[model samples]
Target chain A: MRLLINKIFLALSILSAGVGLAFLAWILITLFMKGLSSFHFSLFLNDLIEGGLRNLIVGQMILAGLASLIGIPLGMTAGIYIQEYGQGRYAALIRDLSDIMMSAPSIVIGAFVYAIVVVPMGGTSGFAGAIALAIMMIPVVINTTDSMLSLVPRELREAGIALGASKYKVIIDIVIKAAKVGIMTGILLAFARIIGETAPLLFTSETSNYFSLNLGESFPSLTVSIYDLANEPEESSRDLAWAASFILTVLVLIINLTGRFITRNKK
Target chain B: MEKIFQKLSLSSATLVFVLLIGIFITLYSAAKPAIDEFGLHFIINPDWNKEIVVETPSLRADTVANDAEDDAIADEDDMILDEDDDEMLLDDEDDTVTKTIYGGLVPIVGTLLTTIIALTFALPIAMGIAVFLAEIAPKNISYVVGIAIELLAAIPSIIFGMWGLYYFAPIVADLVGGYQVSLLTAGLVLGVMILPFMAAITRDSMNTTPAVLKESAYALGATKFEVIKDIIFPYSKVGIIGSIILALGRALGETMAVAFLIGSIFVLPKAINDPTISIPVAMANNFGEASGLGESALFYLALILFIISFAVISLAKFYFLKKAK
Candidate 1:
């Protein structure tokens, strides 16, 4: 009876793992079938207004890129302060709060941005969307930077100090250099996470039909557009949503894999 | 130079604190109008976007007497009773006041029910997968499978939403005999979305158990199940619970996945498969055209969601996971 129970437990565990793999396979296969059916080279070349996705693709890059610009610097510096400068209660407090912020509802962050940025500006803009994404990215970046910086040996920082380097210089020159690859990978993962975000951009940037470079205006967002298109009554719109979803999944997966690959290669 | 750089980094760290407080204040003030209008009753009141015609004695003496103390509260109570029969309150001598009231009970209940359903569905599969990865599988197989699971987590949630709607929901509806988009389908899809995430974290926690403990259990004539149940599970229980709560927090705020499947409507779900709206779905769908008190009500919902998630995550992180760390 005991042996039977053990065998049954093992079988059940394997079956659960199989269930997880099956869902992934099912979703990917469906994505390929539906997405590829609608996919065309022209879909990339033309704007959404022209029955294509050029505008949204470019626009999403700009939003995520701008978010990285804002988030990486602020988050890294905050992380540096947490891991290096501070020693006791305050550092721990910041670390704890940053972790909490990492899990705060993304839509609340969007609402917060909408109230502060969009409301004050009197309209939704690319800037509001980027700011929302940046808020989401900051905590993730801080997490990676804090953990990555912690992994750097004390001996390395001591060596720089022994060589007469100032505290900030040692941190900037040596400590940062040592943790560069890890931080970069973390940032890449952070970018991938935010690039696929839909909720935060729903009302902030509020996706435009036409491509506009102006940050002051409503910007095109691929994820938000997918939500909108999928909900539309038209079958063509639903097909377009699938195609957009496929591109988005491919992009996010590639970035995610590249981040993991970089760390693996380094190890 | 050192001082300047230190100040710069210190201020940046301070920004995180500032942002958290800012989000609270911003949501509170934005939600202020609805909070003031509905008081605490908004949470319990199920009526959303409900307009009622209230009649009061038009005599100046009667109106003046009613306005003496607690005017808004008294008037709202009258409005609630007259909601079903607006015409009954219509009289030539009586002044009719039209008021639109919004309440959060439907979406809040909907959110909690769906989350409960999701947790119920995901908890077992996640535990099983974690056990497989941590103990049963060979290291190489575990490594590849772990990566595959993480990749599932990396897929954008909107894809989950769309796929759930188009492909998954129909099969679910066929089995359960309900609307394609429903609380059940949404919760199940959400379960699928969070499964890999929960499994990966649970696996990490399980892997934290020392080899010696498991080896000792095995040496003592323990089977694989015995070793896991006695050694690994007891050792990693807190971490596993923490992971589950963390997944709970994630599911609570999940928008895109639930939005596609939840059939965005403000009715109370009478059955497991009934179509209803969650707080996030309500905000996602209505934020565009909503104005005045309607918009404020959405912010009110946002504020509640933020606070609930904030408390839930803090409990998981500061209480449960802290010991694990």
Candidate 2:
């Protein structure tokens, strides 16, 4: 009876694992089928107004790029403080709070930005979307920076200080350099995360159909437009949404795998 | 330059601390108007955007007498009053008071119900997958399958929403006999979305169980199931629970995954398969057009969602997971 029970349990475990993998395979197959039917080379060449995705693709990159610019420095410094400079409960407190912030609702973050930035500006803009993405990115970047910096050997810092380098200089010149690959991978993953985000950009950037370079104006967002298009009653709009979704999934998965590959190579 | 760098770093660290409190305060103040108007009653009141007509003292007696004289006629008058309440409020001096009541009961209930459903559907499959990865699978198989599962987590959630609406919901509806877009379908899709996340973390927690303990159990002639039940599970229980709660927090705030599947209505569902709205779905659908109290009410929902998720994540990270660490 015990052996029989064990066999049953093992079978259940394998079945569940198969179930998990089957869904992934199913979703990928469906995406490929629907997305490829609508996919065309023109998608990269023309703006959405001209029936392609160039503007949205460009706008999303800009928003995520701007967020990385703001988030990387601030998050790295904060992470440095937590790992190197912080002494006791205060550092631990910040670490805990950052983790909590990392999990805070993205839509609530959207609402918060809408309340502060969008309300003050009197309209949605690319800047608001970037800020929301930055807020999301900061905690993730901090998490990566904190963990990567922790992995740096203590002797490296000690050696730098012994060479008469000041504390900040030692950290900048040695500690960060030592952990560069891991931090880069973390940033890549964080970028991958925010680029695929739809909820935070739903209201903040509030996707535009036309190409616009002005950060102060409504910006095109691939994810938000996908949501809008998917919900429309027209079949053509949904086909476009599926095509966009396919493109997005491809980008996110490639970036994610690249980050993982870098880490694996380093290890 | 050194002093400037230290100060800059310190302030940036301080900025993270400030940002959390700032979100709380900002949400509070944005939601203040609705808070003052509805108070805690907003949570329990089921009537969302309902108009209540308050008759003047002189007319109250007449309506009461009419109510006693003819119940059907009074019901008709009430319907007409509701239809004309807006125009009457605008034109009247002080004869009648029209109050539009916005309550959160339906969406709040819907949110809790969907989350419960998600947790129920996900827990077993996640546990089974975690166990398979941690114990049953060979190292090569485990590594490849593990990466596949993590890739599932990397898919954008909006794709999940769209796929659930088209391909998944129909099969579900056919199986369960309900509307294509419904609470059951939304919750199940949410389960599918969170399954890989929950499995990945749980597998990590299970892997933390020392190999020596498992080897000892096996040497004692214990079956694999016995070893897992007696050794690894007992060792990693807290970490596993923490991972589950963390996944719970993620499920709670998910907007797009639930938005397309939840049917986006304010009615309280009487059955598991009924169409309903969740808080995030409500805010996502209505925030664009809502104004004045309507907008404030959405902010109120946002504030509630933020607070609930905040507390849940903190409990997971600081309490259960802290112990595991």
- Reference contacts preserved by each model: 0.83, 0.76
Model 2: DockQ against the native? 0.83
Expressed as tens digits, the lDDT of each residue in A87-150 for candidate 1 is 8999899999999999998888999999999989999999999999999999999999999999
CAPRI grade of model 2: high
List of clashing residue pairs for candidate 2:
none
Task: For candidate 1, write residues B180-233 as lDDT tens digits.
Answer: 999999999999999999999999999999998888889999999999998888
Interface RMSD of each: 0.7, 0.8
TM-score result, candidate 2: 0.94
- Give the per-residue lDDT digits (tens) of candidate 2, residues A116-174: 99989999999999999999999999899999999999999999999999999999999
